[model samples]
Target: MSDTLRIVLIVASVLCLLFMLRKISQSKVRIDDAIFWIVGAFVLVIISIFPQIPSWCCDLLGIQTPVNFLFLFMIFILLVKLFYMTIRVSQLESKVKELSQRYALDHMDDEVKQDEK
Candidate 1:
């Protein structure tokens, strides 16, 4: 990897890490969610520090270049995170639907009791 790319990676990773930390401090992002970003930044920093790692990975994966490998790696990680988020959102929606139904039942029972009284 070129020094320019290395420097850019390190800078970007540090910025990302810092941004996530700031978000966590502001209560804008949950720790679990920020964890993915934090880990991603760490990986970026690692690759920046150890160019050989990406080179070896590119060779093993038959990728044309380290830049291509980096892009692919990042895209894959983000896609996995997106998939997890989709599942999580679905689970939350299910729970909300269940709770809404339960609440409606309880409300109906209260109205019926008042009517009988």
Candidate 2:
């Protein structure tokens, strides 16, 4: 990687790590959600400090360059996160629907008794 790219990656990763730490301390983000950002920042810092890691990965993956490998790595990580988020959202939607139906059933008799009065 170029000097500029290395510097930017290191700076950005450190900033990200710090931001995640602050958020965790404030209870702004769940540990599960923040885990990805924390891990990604560490991976980035490692690659930035030792550029040969990406260089070797590029050769193994048959990617044209180290930069391409880095981007692919990031995108893969994001895609996995997105998939998990989708699954979680689906589970939440089903739970909400179930709770709403149960609530309506539980209250139906009360509504009828009030109307009868």
1-117: candidate 2 lDDT, tens digit per residue:
998999999999989989999999999999988888888888888999999999999999899999999888988888998999999999999999999999999899889999999
Off by over 4 Å in 2: 112-117
RMSD, model 2, all Cα superposed?
Answer: 1.9
TM-score of each: 0.89, 0.85
Evaluate model 1: give its lDDT: 0.93
Candidate 1 positional error at 85, Å: 1.5
- Candidate 1 segments whose C-alpha is farther than 4 A from its true place: none
lDDT of 1 by residue, 1-114 (tens): 899999998999999999999999999999988888888889889999999999999999999999999899888988988998899999999999999999999999999999
Q: Ten consecutive residues with minimal summed lDDT in candidate 2?
A: 33-42
Model 2, residue pairs in steric clash: none
Clashing pairs in 1: none
User: Highest lDDT, which number?
Assistant: 1
RMSD of each: 1.4, 1.9
